[model samples]
Every structure is written in structure tokens, then in C-alpha cells.
Target: MYPKMLEVAKSEGNKEAERSFHHANEVEKIHAQLYQKLLDNPGASRETYAYYVCPVCGYTSEKEPPDSCPVCGTKGKMFKKMD
Candidate 1:
């Protein structure tokens, strides 16, 4: 879906749409990889950690948030804590 959207955005010459689709696509790929890693180690001990989500680009991080979001460059203060 993201790839299709990205292509559509590109074809339409919509830079903002293209960027959004591209970022979402890349983030989804990262999420899949993280899920795969967890599946590969089903018996590993789990640790609790606070999660922070970037409101601007949906970037997620455990423990502490980055100084600036790698996805959209949003400031750390803009991130919301996920309870």
C-alpha cells in the first residue's frame, strides 16, 4: 500500500505526499524487523521500558526519546509517552 502510494505521489509530483508515504513505508519495514526479532527469541526474558512516540511522524522509541526525531526532525518534547 505504501509503495503504491509512494509511486502515486511521485507520479503526481507531490513532494509532501511522496515524503509521507516513503517515511511510513520505511517505518513499517523497521517494525516488521523488530517483530521478527522478537519472534526469533520467544523464550528471551522481557524487560519493561517506557515508550515514547513522535506525534509528527509516528516514530517510536523505548527508554528515552531522541533529541530530534529521525523521521520528521520533531523535537523530543513533542513526543508523547505511551502508557
Candidate 2:
């Protein structure tokens, strides 16, 4: 949705496009706040964990990785989402 909003801004440069971009950003901020709130809740912390997947070998992990994959030795950039 954010990319589509940016495309709208690029295709039609006007006040409306700028407004749409700000609105989209605002929505994203709200969503982040909601997620943070959920994570901050007492019982929810144990239920939630960071998730990642190696694109090269389809290995999934419960945390975001850096530099390399622990399972199949893939690079960090090759990681995708398992969520």
C-alpha cells in the first residue's frame, strides 16, 4: 500500500498526492504503535518471537539474522519471511 501510494504520488504530482503519501505514512505509524502495544502486553511477549527464513535453503529461524545463515550458510540478504 505504501508503494502504491508512492506510485500515485509519482504519477500525479499534486496536493492530493502529497496528502495521500502523508496519510499512508500515518497509517503505517499507527500500525507500528499497535504492534508495539501488543508486544508490550505481559503475556504476549512469550507468544511472540521474531521470525525469519533463509531464501536459499528455506531454513526458518526464530530471529532475524546477520551476515550468514546458521543452517545452510546463506547470506543475510537472502533471508525472507517465515511469518
Candidate 3:
């Protein structure tokens, strides 16, 4: 629905709504990929893997977080780790 919302926002000339919907759509795509990876590796061990999440934008990473969030430009140091 974000894509559809994006289209609606575009048609209405709502710049802020368009930006929000576009960002949400892109982030959701990344989340879907991460969830698919988890499904594909059901037997994977947590001892060797972890998730790092950006506090600002909810960007999640299977490894170390990047120096900047791909979604919202949050700093890597602001990311919290989980296992």
C-alpha cells in the first residue's frame, strides 16, 4: 500500500506525503528481504549472527550496521545490537 499511497500522494501534489510513502516502501522492501533470509536459514545459529537496528529509521542489519543508515541517515553508533 505504500506504493499506492505514494502514487496518490504524487497525484495530489503532496510532497511530504510522497516522501514519507516512498521511504516507507523502500524500508519495507528491505525488511521483507531480511525476513526471507531468516526463513531460508531456519537452522542458523545465533552464536555467529546478530541483528543491529537503527534507532531512527528501524533499519535492521544481519551484520554490523553501516556508518550511516541507508534509510534515514542515522549514525552507526546510534544503532542498537540484538541477538
Candidate 4:
């Protein structure tokens, strides 16, 4: 778990590991929320919309990404479309 890794990294005073784990933890939270949303509404996946992910932060969106990533402020155009 990224959070657990982050905690260990913090305790060890490893700044690089802390940063990496922090980033992963943030993305993992977004993924979990997205997965929970889909689980809550099982039919939501029936749509033919495409998914987009922020290259910088791994933020995901359906149909279309926002003008800027809420987590990292990466532009929508920078997001990569999922196949």
C-alpha cells in the first residue's frame, strides 16, 4: 500500500521515497474512488465513452477530462486516451 510505504518513508526520512510514495498514494486514492463509483453504479460502465488519464498525476476521467487536472493541474489536452 502506498500509504503504508509513505509512512515508512516518512519515518525513515527518505525524501525521495516519500515523494514517490505520496504521488502513488494520491493516484491510488483517485483510482479507488473511481472504482467505488463504478461499483456503486454497476450500469455506469455500459456507456461507450472513453477514459482519459493525466500523464502527470494519473487522474482519470470518463468521456472527457476536465480542462485541468484537479490534483496536478495538468492540461486536459495532456491527458492520454485509454484504448
Per lDDT, the best of the predicted structures is 4
* lDDT, candidate 2, 1-83, per-residue tens: 77776877777776677665665575456557656867788686567676675665445555575578654578987777654
* Runs of candidate 3 exceeding 4 Å displacement: 45-48
Model 2 TM-score is: 0.36
Look at candidate 4 and give me any clashing residue pairs.
Answer: none
lDDT of each: 0.80, 0.64, 0.83, 0.86
TM-score of each: 0.78, 0.36, 0.84, 0.81
Candidate 1: residue 68 lDDT (0-100): 92
Alpha carbon lDDT at 61, candidate 2: 52
- Local error of candidate 4 at residue 70 (angstroms): 2.0
Query: How well does candidate 2 score on lDDT at residue 55?
Result: 67
Per-model C-alpha RMSD: 2.0, 10.6, 1.8, 1.7
Better of 1 and 3 by lDDT: 3
| Per-residue accuracy of model 4 over 10-81 as CA lDDT, tens digit each | 999999988877777778888999899889988987766689999997989887989999878899999999
